[model samples]
Target: MESASLDSRFSKPMLDGNRSAGSLEESVSPKPLPVDDSPSAPPKPPNGGFVAWMQVAGSWCLMFNCWGIVNSYGVFQTYYENEMLVYRTSSEIAWIGSIQAFLLLFIGALTGPLYDSGYFRLLLATGTFLMCLGMMMISICTELWQFVLAQGIVVGLGAGCLFIPSVAVLPLYFSSHLAFSIGVAGSGSGVGGIIYSIAFQQLQKSIGFGWASRVMGFISLVTLVFPLLIMRVRSSNPKQKRKVRKLFDSSALRELPFCLFLVWGFFGFAGVYMPLYYVGSYAIETKIMPPALAFYLIPILNAGSVIGRTVPNYAADKTGSLNMFIPTCFGLAVLSFAWIGIHNTPGLIVFIVLYGIFIGAFMTLPFSAVVKLSPHLGVIGVRMGMLCVICSFGILIGTPVGGAVLRQGGWISLQSFGGAALMVSTIFIIATRVAKVGAHPRQKV
Candidate 1:
């Protein structure tokens, strides 16, 4: 009878690491002085001592150096066009960054699951080494394929590893304030973008491309220390080793929320990169705007994005993720169709701020929504990887499409393309709502 009861209790999926009692008496009655079930206790919340916060801060620093620099690649787009890769079309140059972004999301599919099973140290070390090596190697590239392999493949993979581990490990440290912590940590991208933008611009002129990239590579090494020190995974069931296999789980794609998320990602990328790719060029083409000012706005947009990313994440935790996400999508659609279409100085600035905020919210809220919709925390990496696969399709298509529209109809046509894409995002946001309703008729906001 005791064995049967124990088996029944252990069979419950939610009780995977928990103990079960045979009866009320077994649960609460006083036992012999030597009786002990301490080994079966659930994992405790991390103490989040100074060391914990330090770890979080360190993760942010690494993210800033890697993912943050990835976000700021727009600054280099114009420079590469004028100097090194003059033969490449604007669309082709855009592909380099697009692939970089695509890989950042695409590689997550495998890394997420690997991380869940307890390869945190291995993953972080691999990402750090690859990223530093890729940056250093990129300094010598003078052709398209070299850039593609070094920047597109290697750096993309490194950023992908960095992204999943940083996000996944944080939950183990802070459960209640996860959103806030993520927001604070995510701000690293913005800070990194600003620093690199300034450094790359100044150093490209003073130190040359090789040394500028080498300097950034050195900074990446300094930022990797936090992940080395603070990341930890507390296993609830030590006897159960995390089984490793091919990490991509296609089954997650069938779920309605993830499908809607893919649609959202496609349109989201289609709209977000329009400004990133075109803003400086647009400013230069107008001839009235100075080159320095045009270069200055990219980082400014990213600075606003830092705030946009953090604040909406905090708000989404209070409000519903869907509620925050949908409105931001609609707002971006409006900013694209309306403000960017105007083509004047004031109109362009307004579009930049509006789009930055919406994109910031878009990035933060979607991950939160994915987590909320997932059936189990253990599979978050897999689910996130699946989401990235979908998102990569968007990144792959978005900028080149925008560039094509610009070629065919000029700035006006590009704005129209952005608007249309954002409208598609709004449609998907509505689809998400419908999917939620179908899943739970009486579900509250």
Candidate 2:
């Protein structure tokens, strides 16, 4: 999801001993002045420096694997539907991408705690191996189940392991310009999508699917190594796992604004990727463009996202993340409907570009919104993790459901279904904002 919430993403890692969160501010002192938490680390953060920015760089690399690959699965969806998995329905093939996306986020509940327990290096090495191994296995896969197993589960879990730590450590380093830093790192999702889509699109035509997939895997393995070397987070004693709480901690879910935000995410995300997963296939089906040109849509959308992810976040830092986030959700809802009107080549391209910008902002803002909306510092991780997990379920069920709709209702219905879902999601997102800040339009919230 590349959901970049701060200490909710970063709080625990900043302290000297890697002391778990929640009790730190209280255990060390009863003083009302918010001066000290753990004596082991400095009272203030090293907000800007070479090392701090490198963490951003490493996270950018991680986003390439975590979401870049997931977003580009549209190319695979088209290829599988046309060539490899003709026996399968679009709904059936979508499970591969859906489950891949699901596990990448679903396991956040577990990975978040384990990372806090000082398992960073172990998770990184193991995740990188699994990602490369899964891609290699994809090269040889002949069956639908094989693709699902290799790409869906193995690679999904590997990304999940790497993802939590990628966003988690950022808070320990920065404070004032946190959202901008995360936006830069988060943009890697778009960067990865563009490169990987182009790689597979060009290579598979020349070398065939097996080697094309393996080449992507090779890139994943090599590029991933930089993050392993450059990213450095000191760990706590494995035994003293203080402050680590579970992702779906029950107490956090009971909050109204948080729960409402979860609703917005679930339905909004359900419709969000419908276009991304199906646009290429739609172009081919409608004959608006040949397969040659249709292939570029994925890369083009991702290319637009390169700006969408960073620019909106930079703006959000001033306007407030959710302040910008709510309108972006509305833009996505509008674009999903506008996609229905795009019949000609230019219109389709415009649709893709606008969708890219809106969705990129949509994908980037949630973690920041969650961080600000949290009731207190102690449970930010709990709240943010819950938001991510619930949203993962939405991503899991969304596109396959769209495929089923596509099967029954045709493209108009498919577009309508996606649009309607986003509208509902937009309503809920507005409700969440209103609930948080009482419909005060002038207020920055």
Candidate 3:
């Protein structure tokens, strides 16, 4: 009876001391175990392996067909304004491209939720069908609404559907080296722009507009199949039904760093495509380069982008994605400013190459940066979707607004606008970095 009473008295104080220790542990010291490595912890990505790389290859094909064609829109914009849709004002014509840009970012709002809920194949098949169908439809379009409906709305929706999964799914297979892999995959966009731009320029001259677009449709159909066959999600809860109410992650908005980066993307994209859209025309306007040579500027830019996309991403794996991204944004801003003063072919070519390099790096680094900021792989889709949806507004208005300025104030004014937007965007990126890791130069961000 005396031993039992003594045990009971010691147990109560021991429990109290343990409770105090727990509080002190949280307050003053690191836990013995990592929170992320507990039994109910999230599944880890493979980081790198054969299947992971094949996933990258598949994603490459999708990006090639989706963003690739969008990047080539400058070629189309110039073509329609000069020959096909000559009856329309530049601002009116700008709306078609704007709508296309808007959908590319905007449709992620729906697709992101679907992807996270395990609807990968359904989204992929549907996207393939719509994108191919839209391209074929573009061939037959001779009217403005037809272009807007087919190219802007149909193609944009298809591309957006294809894009979200490719970007979101791949990151699930990689925790480290994500920037490099994504950069390599994204290089397809540059390659696709080069192929489509050259094909459109040559084919339209040889076979006519209708056939050129059909040929592009056929190419997209072929390339997109590879991705559809190989891509999938590595789900931690494959059998669990996704909550309908949880489709969007509202908590992401509370992250000041993520929001700052989103704003950075917003204002950055506002002028990102301006050079691609207007460089060819600018060349023709200055009469410095022959029309034939002027037509090559977009291709030149895209060619340089191929290198820019791959190389910076490799470097970003080490120096930090946002670290590299900030300087590139500044470089792009300077390039936009300088593009306005180039009245000679050599200078134009130099500008195009530099612009391609910086923009390629700009496009390549941001996605990986977003991935770095996410706490869970499952939430990646939602976060990326939201960023795209938010940035879509900037891309939507960018070309139309720039085109309007072009119509009213000439090339100098448009250049200034593009440059200003980029400069402002760089400031936001710096703010994002500050919020993330503070001002320590050695910090990886």
Please name the candidate that would achieve the greatest TM-score relative to the true structure: 2
Whole-structure CA lDDT of model 2:
0.81
Task: List model 3 lDDT by residue over 1-445, tens digit each.
Answer: 1323332221111011233323322322222211233232335666678888999998888888788888888888888877899898777788887888789878866776677566888889988999999999999999999999999999999998988777766656765556777888899999998998999899999999999999999999999888877777765544545433234566677888888988887899898989888887777777887767778888889999999999998887667777888899999999999987888878889999999998899887877677556543334456666777778999899989999999999999999999999999999998988888888877665
For all candidates in order, the CA lDDT equals 0.70, 0.81, 0.78
Instruction: Tell me model 3's lDDT, rounded to 2 decimals.
Output: 0.78
Q: For model 2, where is the 10-residue window of minimal lDDT?
A: 27-36
Ranking by lDDT: 2, 3, 1
Superposed by TM-score, candidate 1 places the C-alpha of residue 357 at a distance from the truth, in angstroms, of 2.0
Total colliding residue pairs, candidate 3: 0
Estimate, for each residue in 1-445, the C-alpha lDDT of model 1 and write its tens digit. 1323333222111121222211111211122111113554334435377756776786687678666877778777877776788788778888888888888887766676677667778888888988888889889999988988887788888888888777765655555556677778888887787787777777888999999988888888778766677666555567755555345555566778668877788777767678776777788777636666677667777787788778988876666567677788888888877855455777677667777777767777776676555544334455566677778888888988887778778888888888899899888877886776554433322
Q: Any residue pairs clashing in model 2, and if so which?
A: 6-9, 6-10, 7-10, 7-11, 20-242, 20-243, 21-243
lDDT value, residue 232 of candidate 1: 63
Ranking by TM-score: 2, 3, 1
Instruction: Please write out the lDDT profile of model 2 over residues 1-445, one tens digit for every residue.
Output: 1123433333444343223222233322122212224443333446678988999999999999888989899999999999999999999999999999998888765687777666777888888998889888999998899999999999898888888878877877766566777889999999999999999999999999999999999999988999999997744333444556656656556667778898998998799999889999999999999998999999999988888889988887667777788889899889998888889999999999988988889988887787667644445667777777888999999999999999999999999999999999989988888887779886565
Model 1, which residues run further than 4 Å from truth? 1-42, 237-239, 244-254, 376-379, 438-445
Runs of candidate 2 exceeding 4 Å displacement: 1-11, 14-38, 41-43, 234-242
RMSD of each: 6.9, 5.1, 9.2
Residue 248 in candidate 3 has what lDDT? 53
